[model samples]
Target: MEIVTGMKKITFGVFLLLLLSSFKLEASNYTFGVRIVGKGKPMILIPGLKGSADTYNDVVAHYKDHYTCYVITLAGFAGQPASAELNHPLKGQRDEIIRYIIEKRLHKPVLVGFSFGGTLAIWIASTRPDLIGALIELDGVPFDAGIEKNHVNMDSIRRDARFRNEKIIDAQADYWQHVDSVRHTKKFREQGFLDMKELVTDTTRINQILDWDDLSDYKASRLMVNEMNSLDLRDSVSKISSPILVLGSWKGWVNFKTKETVAARYQKQYSPADKVTIVFSENGKHFLMYDDFNWMIGEMDKFLKSI
Candidate 1:
């Protein structure tokens, strides 16, 4: 009888341990293709240019122990496919996010954007301020407003347009091919920033959903990029109502006569005021999040906690 009771006790303990482990796993996994571990206000992450949900893998690992994190991969850019046409540009992307929030009933979720994704977050906060509880801008500022300084040479833009009536698969294949080709370049090889050598999935599959002919799709994003290249947001920082956190990279991606010169110019161009707190990672590049992951994660945690 003594040996039987001991056996029963051991079995019960093992079962209890298994039950607890299952509970923990379930708590850590959440819907919306996002994983959350802790209990707090939820945070949504928007990725960078030519980026995907996979890009946030490191960032998510850093923050998972703290907040309920939602990492979103925007349509057309990453591997995510759209049910409808990719006819909408930035504004369309914003609207889709808004609709997601409403449908999911995500309460005052903190919105975080990185690089090009940063512009989209700003658009949402500017247009749908009520949906957001707080905004985190990762090295992204608004475009300078004005026709004179921000005017585009349409002829040059026309000449440079790569997506004119291009099919989605063909465009994506070409884009990735360019990416693969660039990876072998001396400059990129030296940097070690390229994605993996063997891509398990052909990302070109996403291009099938895009509707290049849809002006509604191309208009806003094109305009925004144009204005961004032409104008400096330094003068207009005061206009943004939401609390802004600006981050700048020390290095620039492309070849410049001098990187220091480019960094200094960029820093001076988008310096924020008292209402906005700016953080600079001296070792970072345009993709500051990836360049300075721990610093950014700490900064984000500190900011989110304070808010």
Candidate 2:
């Protein structure tokens, strides 16, 4: 029965093909899991630190009708297993993302990053403007350090508060070891929830955030935070050729803080870019997407559709 044998071989081949496809989408060798949606130009959606794909659920629903959404959950975040390369997890993942873009042949794909993902998106576009079409950042700055530098100078901000007390290698590692060790305890979630409450206004969302944080690899998350603050994209912003739209929020800090003052910060950071627009939410917290959905959507739609 040659015909029957041939069918069996074809079936096995199809199964293997599907297996490989699943593995690829799993981002096994990379630093993120990609879930594709809709049918149009590629639009990558990156969430905040320790955030999962669910973070972009509403945003994806909004954009899917027009753009194909590639929802990426970074490695070691929200239950995704930590990648073997952990020392410089954030930068390492940037390279992986570039590889995915080129390999996937997603020419001039739009990048939408939220919070830390927004920063990562900036890094991606700055790294290769040739591969990106547009960048949409939600509450993600070009660089975030506690210092008030007259300009964007990474060298000057190198030893800020975070690193001032972080020179010792062994001690830092041991500290993170202890930090992650208590992940299963209620104290971990409670503490994380308390800090997140300041950023996320919604009580329900804060609870969800705590869950994601506990599932995320503590060392990896902290390493990413360290990497983000250490690097300055103010100079590299000139490298980006694609259009950028940055939507931020000001949680109304006391004393002489206007929307313009807040918006000026983003303007200063992205000053080197050729095509960029900055907008701020009148009354919203750090998670602009959720806190200021209508205004954010309007800004996003105008900026994106115009491009």
RMSD of each: 10.8, 3.7
lDDT of each: 0.55, 0.80
| Position 58, candidate 1: lDDT | 74
State in Å the error of residue 73, model 2.
0.9
Per-residue alpha-carbon lDDT of candidate 1 for residues 1-307, written as tens digits (9 for 90 to 100): 1223444644666767778999777533321133344455677888755456665677777777766777876544444433243333444667777877777688988888886777677667666766777778776656422212335464554444434423332455566557556644666543432332121122232221111112112223344354334433455544446566666553433444454654454455445433456676666555555556778778877876676
RMSD of 1: 10.8
Candidate 2 residue 12 Cα shift, in angstroms, is 8.7
**Displacement of the residue 14 alpha carbon in candidate 1, Å:** 30
Query: Which digits, one per residue and each the tens of the lDDT, describe model 2 over residues 186-242?
Result: 877788788776787898999888888878887667667777778777778899998
